[model samples]
Target: MEIEAISRTYSPEMACVIFCCRVFIKTAAAEDLEQFVAYGDIDWNEVYRLAALHRVRPIVYRVLNNTNIPEPTLTRFRNYCRALSVFAFERQIESARIKQVLGQQGISVRMYKGLDFTKVVYGGDISLREFTDMDMMIAPGQLSAMVNVMKAEGYVCSQVEYLRRFPTNFVTNKKDICFYKRSPMGRLFGFEFHYRPTNFMMDQSPGFDELLGKDSSPFTHEQYYRLMVLNHGASDYYPNLRSLVDIVMLSQGRVVDVPPKLRRYERLGQELASRLLNSPAPAVPADKPLLKCATLITEWQLTATPRSGWEKMYMHIRFSSSFLHTLRLMLRAMHYFALPNEKDINNVQLPLFKLYYLAKPVRLLNIPSRLKKVFS
Candidate 1:
């Protein structure tokens, strides 16, 4: 409902106060409300109902323009968030210990996804980012041994069974080998053991090792930070304003002599921010959508680079126009029948290559019609 309509019932001054409170709580949690209110002259009673409503509200708008709330009220707003922070901190401490222990066993384990995310994004440890458990990335060959090591340290492998057609989900705990009833929520988070990140994509790219070979020095926390930010953008950045705020936090603290290794990462972050601004995706607020997206894009592009053929392909597909998305495979298919991608000494100019690529979807559309005539 419009603020004006709602204001008719309450005092205009009270309505204005409530509106300000809503804006504050938009980004600042209820625990932080007091500090935010200190800046304004509004009384607690004036905003109590508003804050109460905020606690119960569904956070309908995923994006917001600005937040003026104080930081103090954040803790009081929700226990779930506080629980999340405690869980993350404990998990990080545990994971770090596990890493050290596993290293001594001749089994090197690399931390992946969430733990790395907390490390890189907050600059040291963002225990406040509300992560559940820890996820470590180990080589597929090393998974059995790694699992055993974890099991000895109070973690039992989790087993939730779903049909094979569905994408895999796993959570291992200290009690059971697998718990179909328990989610990966707060217990033992998912550890997606992958030799390569590119394996999950539409096209196989060069593995993480290939990228590491080409100057993997700044490949610690900052690398993870860039990945999470980009992944969030791709996923439309679900349910959490704090996730986007984490991007803002990660972008800070580089005013002095910036490292050359992170230059590419910084550029990528900038590009993400710019592109998000340009598209103004569904989750972005209209007021600062472009600005936020552009900022994120710029920071990401600064750190990430295409390392393999698969990486290159992913980049091309992800950044390509819609037309490229539909026709890329078709062009590959037609290479067998038409012209070659190689540079011949004669340099034959066969325009059919372009024609075939362009007509891919149309050809797909005709298949049904052709079948109908045969059936008739």
Candidate 2:
């Protein structure tokens, strides 16, 4: 399945931005960050913008502050990313309280993504993990209980306005429920409760019987690592760079026997992460056939970061590394077109609410030409 790598070209500025971000990783050596900064003449605004796009400003902010880069620019960047640590801390604390309540109520909850990811990847430091929202998972049967518990924890019910414009599949297909709330400080926060974290071929979501068996051992917690790898690289249409960061950090010096299906993407993720970020990623056995075509997908995506709003989303879903990935993208699109999201159910009355299904194709057909211009 090898084809010549697609000729994806990146501006020098974007490449520098990407390189600088890798320097902030815990595994990155200070010498590398210093040497790159020493010779690079970067536009501060462009670099900041790119870092913000990848949601790595917290790390980028730290890198800029520690370097000999001008103080005024660093100060401005600091102010912009200043809220990250506080927000991350706030989310962590709130999530902890919620988890405690769930435990006392005989309900099960596991933190993943935003809060827990930082602990694993950033060594339990809240400041290092900047995320869009806090994510947790609970059994489907406990969803109602989870909502009540969150409400009691001072979280108010809020709707995802964006989902109103999309199809039901967009929300339902993921098999996760997202809840929104406004913090005491007037900041909006979210908690995404995923019933199925990753529906990849390897999904072995704990059956209700296994809820109490959540492994505490770092190594033996096989399900945690499995979900992390699949969500970041294989199962998702939009791959997160942090997932690759996790693999490099989590799998280093290990010799676990990875499933054949899972191993390919695991290796691909590490290699792509290493290539894109200019970081030292762990490697799999060389004898295994490489998905050479993935580089193009990675290259196209890595170079185009710092995009916002629509452009960011277009890249997230449109970029593909392989045949199966393209098919997954199509399936997701079908979900978006045919499935009615929570917004639809709320705004539409029962019985007539079924019309929302009819609305998907119509809304898709009506997607503004400007929004479609990127693909063209």
Candidate 3:
């Protein structure tokens, strides 16, 4: 869709965001961006707020730095981008060291998203992308070895430690575990080790070997595209501009053959990217209702509008591909939220695991205060 259509469908602020963060290959002309900025009704403050909410501040800054935005607004983005660049550089060095340590222990790792995409998709411009943690995919059988190696290197596996006190079933069903450590500068870094490519609730995740293929080469564009689609779906189709940018950049010149089970969600993601970033639409048709619902949720997320639990659940159901799929997701969600996890127990063991469910409601009552602290 065009910027005018985006403005009408969403708002002028969102249209400005699209103009600033659209993929470089298909980016609107310089004059077009300037024209949007020139409009008196344009809210530069709202643009900055939405850009930061969508985690695309760096990309926005890159496009608008030379434009006529207010110096105060431009300064905020400039300072954020500069800080992100420094952190990204530090992360790169730390990641290499972690990868080398794992390699020496005979564990082959494939890094995904985050820094990897910054290099491959954004041409090594770390300022254009932000990643909170490192995602590494390793063989399922080697998870124990990988965790040990990371701990030896001073990374703490709190998730693993939490799971240890739980039943074996919890450990078996996990798709990944995160290891965290503080750099000498006191900057916290997370390294997530994945045994499976996607979440457990999703369709059977591809094996590590299958993703790497026989020769175990790095991920091809198609592989990255497939993983990206699955990850986006797993995230409940949240409309993140950085993720949409990845979709546009990775699908630039290739036909990505997503698995049959995941094609619907891929089309949903493509439709979102196509609408927001002006990327090419997917060949497959998406369910209209699902698309409409997703668009509504996207608007809410991008605007930082609060969504009630029921509203979120309704949208998740609407995004489902089929009745059976909806049922599965609902059941999984209920099982997840109803059952007490590490957070509920806080390392306290109970004679009956069922008892944790009772504490669930009490724990949920504290959410409002927690949210206030976070957003204050």
Better of 1 and 3 by lDDT: 3
For model 1, the superposed segments whose C-alpha errors exceed 4 Å read 1-75, 78-82, 123-125, 151-192, 202-206, 210-222, 234-243, 252-324, 327-376
Q: Give the TM-score of candidate 2.
A: 0.73
Candidate lDDT (C-alpha), each: 0.40, 0.59, 0.74
Deviation from native of the Cα of residue 273 in model 3, angstroms = 2.1
Q: Cα deviation of 209 in candidate 1 (Å)? A: 3.6
Of 1 and 2, which scores higher on TM-score? Answer: 2
Better of 2 and 3 by lDDT: 3
Best by lDDT: 3
Q: Taking the tens digit of each residue's C-alpha lDDT, what string does model 2 give over 1-376?
A: 1111211255545655555556655445667666666776667777677666665666677666778877777887787666777788788788887789889998887777676766765677777745877777677677667767777776755433323334343334545667777877888878888776555223343332232235644423344455555566555523545555566655555554444556666667667766665555565565323444355546555665333434433433444445686677667555544666555556545454457787655455765565679678
Model number with the top TM-score: 3
Runs of candidate 2 exceeding 4 Å displacement: 1-9, 22-29, 152-174, 199-213, 216-224, 237-240, 256-258, 278-293, 305-336, 352-356, 362-376
User: What digit string (tens of lDDT, one per residue) describes model 1 on residues 90-144?
Assistant: 6677668778998998887666556566556544544434454455445545655
Q: What is the lDDT of residue 59 in candidate 1?
A: 23
The per-prediction CA RMSD against the true structure, in angstroms, equals: 14.4, 6.9, 4.6
- lDDT of model 2 at residue 17? 54
